[model samples]
Target: MESSVPALPSVLLKDGELKDVEAKPVIIGGMVLDIHATPSVPANPRTTTPGKVHYILGGVARNVAECMSKLGAKPYMISVVGLDMAGNLLLEHWKSAGLSLDVAAESGIPVWFEPVSVVKSKRVVSVVKHITFASPNEDELIAMANALSCGEVFSPIQKDNKKNKCSTESLFQMLRPAIWVLLEEGIKVVVVTLGSDGVLLCSNGAPGFMKGSSKGSNPHGSGNQLYRLVNSSCPPNRFFSASKFEGGSNLFAAHFPALPASVVRLTGAGDCLVGGALACICAGLNVMQSLAVGIAAAKAAVEVDTNVPTEYSLAKITDDAKSIYFATKMMFCQSML
Candidate 1:
């Protein structure tokens, strides 16, 4: 049967002129709203301090799309905003940013806040959810887990039961099942941001094809079916590595620590990571390489107060990430030996 999906646009004009164009769209679905916040100040329980207030576009899905756009990908936003002045302004901003807003519409506003302290710590508190936002409910999550676990949803949940606060294994245990389920559902790739632990990723297969495979080799051959896991370091020096597991692999995992940065704010770091990773993948980079780019994007985001970068070069970031990845890998291996 014929499909309605249109062919991806070519990188040439109809007149046979060479051009650069991206046809693949990264559709981000979630909340959209206007954010108003005061500059960073000392934390006080019962005092009001004078500070400058600023407003900008904010939301999980929206920030992700913005990051993707900055990373040089075509992003389509599927979200709802207030029907008032804020919504109208948001639509204008999206249009100006070159995003496809055909799926965007107007609705009610969802308010959020950003609070920073003298120590430079930040916290975001969500005040409400708009009717039009698309967030997965508990039922859906449970169903996904069940399907992934092959009907083991009701099994006894494992608790970290550890007093140590810096336990990545404990945290990984808590997140592994859900991520595994998503990958099992043919998600291709799943990334989990673990605050202090850095980022963890799961995938069904390596991007592109197995390394060292002969010409005309099947990309999906059994040699590439190993499960993988990686853990990246956190903060001081963001380092990462991966391990491959043998068997009929259903999932692979890896982690990379946060890159060094003078963090101004952490507003939309996670969104930036997701958007960056997706953009790299769409650009034909492997999952591991895409993750490196994601880390670089997030590092750039925290270097400024805004959710997305005002100026960035995707090529430069990709190159920097590759260099850092190789250096970190060398250091990691040396330490292990």
Candidate 2:
């Protein structure tokens, strides 16, 4: 479909007109909400910042869409938002980016609000999104968790449990349909951000985990972290090299399993990481390479305090990871032989 507004220079716009054209805009369908918080930088070693909570649009769809837009990709978002002030801002952000948001559904519910928390030393931040929102029934939640976990263990935190009406299983079920819908669309790449466990990436009919160890800290530069990792790991260049998707690498990587265990910083890092990875893949790299890039992106993100000027090298990260993986493989092979 054609975008209503002009995409960045990298987008493949169909025809000369924006909107309602035959352009193959990348579609990210998900939820949007608002965030309020008091956060501090990990490097500065400061105490928490404080504030009254307010609503703002946030969610994976918006995060990825925004990142892709910045990276010169034509992205359209599909999400659930209410017609409240927060929702209005959500629409505004998309329109300003010249993104296509007409496909988004209005929930009419009170806008989802989150309070963000940040710690400087840990480079961590936590955001409570969907804090008083309605939840789906128990059966649905169970189904979702099952599908999402791929039968592995997925323990939701206690804080999340208090907000929901049913077992953790039920919550996953409720979330699955929305995720499934995005898959139904012709998305070449699908990324599922698994909070602290890392990411579940689906592309070309295969799926697997990036499986970085959890960083036990709050959410922070995760999204940017993921972006850098995926971008750097991309092929030919392999470890760390600059391409179109370098600016937000750290935020992208923040979503990897590495975040919960490594360190924490801000609320939106997961979104940023997801967006960055999407941008890298959209730029045409293979899956493993994309993942390597994502890891590097995240590593870079975790090292800094706030978003700032940064550098990335995907080839270097990939080469290092491969060398490690191969050495381990060789030892195992030698033992077997």
Candidate 3:
């Protein structure tokens, strides 16, 4: 979200005709073939256990675009999926969805970047310096912080100690330096994803984020059924800030709990989470609503083997997202140097 990779204008199909609007939002990243091998029973790592293997279309960017498409936005993907069997599968599925394969050289759309790893995550320092939003895990967070700081400034937290298991509060404190670095580097929002514990959304007091409405979508006419449903469920109960709190007085951070789910595989939870949020942002929901919707999408991902749920239930997403959005609270908001 460095500038605005979202705010996808509502493009609806009415009476078998395409709605008048701007070009489709563009997504730049990878189109990879994901091979998943699951064992039927617990066994030693040295031996392969009897399990099922399936080939699926996956890539961080691809997953996000697919998720956005499922949520009702036709995003033009910019990535490398060549004329091979795997590439054809990826393209065919996207083509089937009515998503555009067209790639524009530069559209100036807002960009949202996800760290691929601890090392390569540093490759996008320039991107970070101008990024409006980022979601980095623990190691990647520290790495980006180091690159931003122009030095080795952080170390991994040791979780083996029973007395110092790095609880949420402590984790926040430890990563606060890193978060501070990212925020200072012009990154507007830094969402730290903690497995099971949920997410930490930190910001350098970005405008409209903690206020009235930060929705990114601009609807044209009636909009689609799904996008309309999406807009209705946003602006969480507590999205409005009380007058008592001084504006832009402190760094902002909030915690959202992970929804309870029947476990399957966690391989795609984080990817789907980003996908869901990006989709909502494009659909015109504010950050809180979008994140909630994203989490709901992730819940769906964990329930199924696919990186993204084959189909999303707007009703179910709204219901589950409302709970998360309402329950979320600003856990930290104080001036910190």
What TM-score would each prediction reach against the true structure? 0.58, 0.39, 0.81
Pairs that collide in candidate 3 are 1-111, 1-112, 1-132, 2-131, 2-132, 4-110, 5-110, 217-284
In TM-score terms, candidate 2 sits at 0.39
User: What TM-score would candidate 3 get against the native?
Assistant: 0.81
Identify the leading candidate in terms of TM-score: 3
lDDT of the candidates, in the order given = 0.45, 0.34, 0.68
Among all candidates shown, the one with the greatest lDDT = 3
Steric clashes per prediction: 11, 90, 8
Candidate 3, superposed: residue stretches over 4 Å from native: 1-4, 7-23, 39-51, 95-108, 160-166, 210-224, 230-237, 242-249
Per-residue CA lDDT of candidate 2, range 163-271, in tens? 4545323433434443332233322233444444344332222222221112222122223443344333322333122122222111111112332224444444544
Residue 149 lDDT (model 2) = 36
**By lDDT: ranked, best first:** 3, 1, 2
